[model samples]
Target chain A: MASNKEDVKLLGMVESPFVSRVDIALKLKGVEYKYEVENLQNKSEFLLKYNPVYKKVPVLVHNGKPISESLVILEYIDETWKQNPILPSDPYKRALARFWSKFIDDKIINAARKALYTHDEKEREKGVEEIEEALHLFENELKGKFFGGDEIGIVDITAVLIAYWLPIIQEAFGAKLFTSDKFPKLYNWSQDFNNHPIVKETLPPRETLMAYYKGHYERHVASNK
Target chain B: MASNKEDVKLLGMVESPFVSRVDIALKLKGVEYKYEVENLQNKSEFLLKYNPVYKKVPVLVHNGKPISESLVILEYIDETWKQNPILPSDPYKRALARFWSKFIDDKIINAARKALYTHDEKEREKGVEEIEEALHLFENELKGKFFGGDEIGIVDITAVLIAYWLPIIQEAFGAKLFTSDKFPKLYNWSQDFNNHPIVKETLPPRETLMAYYKGHYERHVASNK
Candidate 1:
């Protein structure tokens, strides 16, 4: 458990799924910390100083040392706090968790981003195909209730984008990429994940997310036109 | 130390820098393992079974369980072997190492690949600019003799591409993108990294890599035309 003496601060934006990941991890570990929301357009000097390389949010500053990258921060939080272990104990299982977490980020998220945002019809179609294929793999891999096998682990944490943000973004764009019919298992898993106690509290309200993503989608469409 | 009872096997292709990272980590840990070279053009069923998601090389199979992704494999090896510690002990330091390793993969490698292989002059120039900016960040980060300070660690292991393959790739393409003058610290570090005993053993022969890359570059150019 994190001690009261420890000074932990998270620089993030309310709407970022990445920031939500850190928040959920800290909450799972029963650790309390300061959440300083950053305006993405004009990032603060502190955020830049902390994460000079990427200058992005979800930077976890513990005792004045900054750890950037949400996935990296999740691991750090797990290691530092030790309770409600986010990753598995066995080396092979831990490797599996890391592999799935990375797949979500590299394959699913990237393809979903393209599918939701791209103006080109052909490119958007390709992106949708790629994301479905990637999601199908996840659907096949889900032998248990959740990706974490009855518990919310790193894979489930990293897949927050797929569970929460993807649906909202698709709604905002008036697109149907991830359907319950096509991916029933993944759809169910997302439902369970969203309803998880910690995740429920950590996630932004649906209406708020819808409003934000709608504005973003409209701006993207306007700019393209 | 890995015992003789441990059944370890590595499925890899000779020329891949990603494969070399696993090889170097295995050597550094003094872990005895069988190395099976895979013909990437006609990938074996074994490779497909082990890494169905990516169907890529550098899959580490330990006692029947398989681990894919070079960075994921490196961490698995470090945890399993518990010798020649590839990653730092402290949580914060480990996070930093993960951060930089990811930067090398996501920014530097992606940009370098585009710069080296892109058919369009504008895209190639853009790639060169992106790679240079990314490398400048690395150059600034290199405060010691090595990224790991005194010993070779995961960051240095992941950076094998920049040390060995990049120079050969540039020469094969008849492009001089990574000049020593522009990044003296990174250049010196690369030289040191290349000369390290484990890395020296793990890297493919210079002529062999040059021959392979030259063939690849020619094929790419011919196909683009």
Candidate 2:
């Protein structure tokens, strides 16, 4: 399976949760790729051409073909390279993993994105309720160690990004929603996922992330105010 | 394979777009499932039991283990049944299908739902731009007849639901969006999909769906205003 392929490049920013999702996926599969950081405020021409639709970061380039969505890129990474496979071999199990991943992607994580900067009372509350309700289900349904039962897989990756990033966002915004006591299972799982060697090495330092987010939150607040 | 393996029941509503994605997948696969309509506004015990998290529609109950999320249900359908396969066996092809499916799911179709009901002009434009951008990609990327290439498949199901549903939604709100000239590929594809014998037989009539959405839209606007 080892072969020299086309030049692989990644268009992303350091602080993007969305970009981080793709970064983690690529690292997990041990696929070699060039990382080209994109400025979200002023996107590069290549980033714009590669991903004109959303114009978001974490756009992966493989043999000159660009796949923008993180989840999509994850699947492509797994498919194109056989080493360090991401998806399970069993079809049903794969489906289950994908389901939980989609659940996290579509609802819990996306819902939390809105809650981060929402200053309006009703909007913030709506976002909080959405997160709380979602976490309640996440805590209850995932009785096992990981979303993939005993194994740490793609769903685990999706959930982990939220867990780690959520706290940073919360701290930046002064909104403490994900308490250890409130979501014990999720809390522990987050710790476990972060502790993994691959995850440990790949993640940007918390202090760095926090510092970046501090400026981000201040800008957001000032603009809104 | 179709011996006596319990009943396959789908809890969904005609008005719900997420449920519609699952329905199209099921229909395309030719998998027989008992459709149990659930009104989300008036939450049902069954709905809660089947999907406690979102409590939304498009929950597929297979031997009592309920799987929610339309994309998740679509994957589950493809995995469980070998009849008419929705996903391709080739990994790269499968990834392409998933990429486009997730792309459309995240941006175009799902975003449109919020746009239809929002009174805010900015929010409305956000939704419209999302749909427009997605359609542009769809028209450009889909060089063949279907998003699935020659025949109908996952991307077809995803595209069909969004394109056709737009008109129904427009009818409901006394507006228009799905113009023929604007999105030639997606618009024409919607027609082909809707006109197919299988799709024609299964899909709800446009007039029926239009009438259903009209009342639904009016009530929300009146109350919200």
Instruction: Give me the runs in candidate 2 sitting further than 4 Å from their true place.
Output: B120-130
lDDT of 1 at B144: 80
Model 2 TM-score is 0.90
Candidates, DockQ: 0.95, 0.59
Clash counts per candidate, in order, are: 0, 0
lDDT by residue for model 2 (A56-135), tens: 88898887877877777777777787676678877666776777777787778766867777768798888888888878
Give per-residue lDDT, candidate 1, residue B194: 95
B124 in model 2: Cα distance from truth in Å?
A: 4.1
lDDT of 1 by residue, B148-200 (tens): 88999899999998888899999999988787998888899999999987788
The C-alpha stretches of model 1 lying farther than 4 A from their native spots are none
Error of 1 at B39 (Å): 1.3
- Give the fraction of reference interface contacts each candidate recovers: 1.00, 0.66
What's the lDDT for residue A171 in model 2? 92
Per-model TM-score versus the true fold: 0.97, 0.90
CAPRI tier for the interface of model 1:
high
Q: Per-residue alpha-carbon lDDT of model 1 for A1-225, expressed as tens digits? A: 567799999999889999999999998898989999899899999999999888999999999999999999999999999989999899999999999999999999889988988999899999999999999998887878887787899999998988998898899999998878988889999999999988898899999999999999989999897
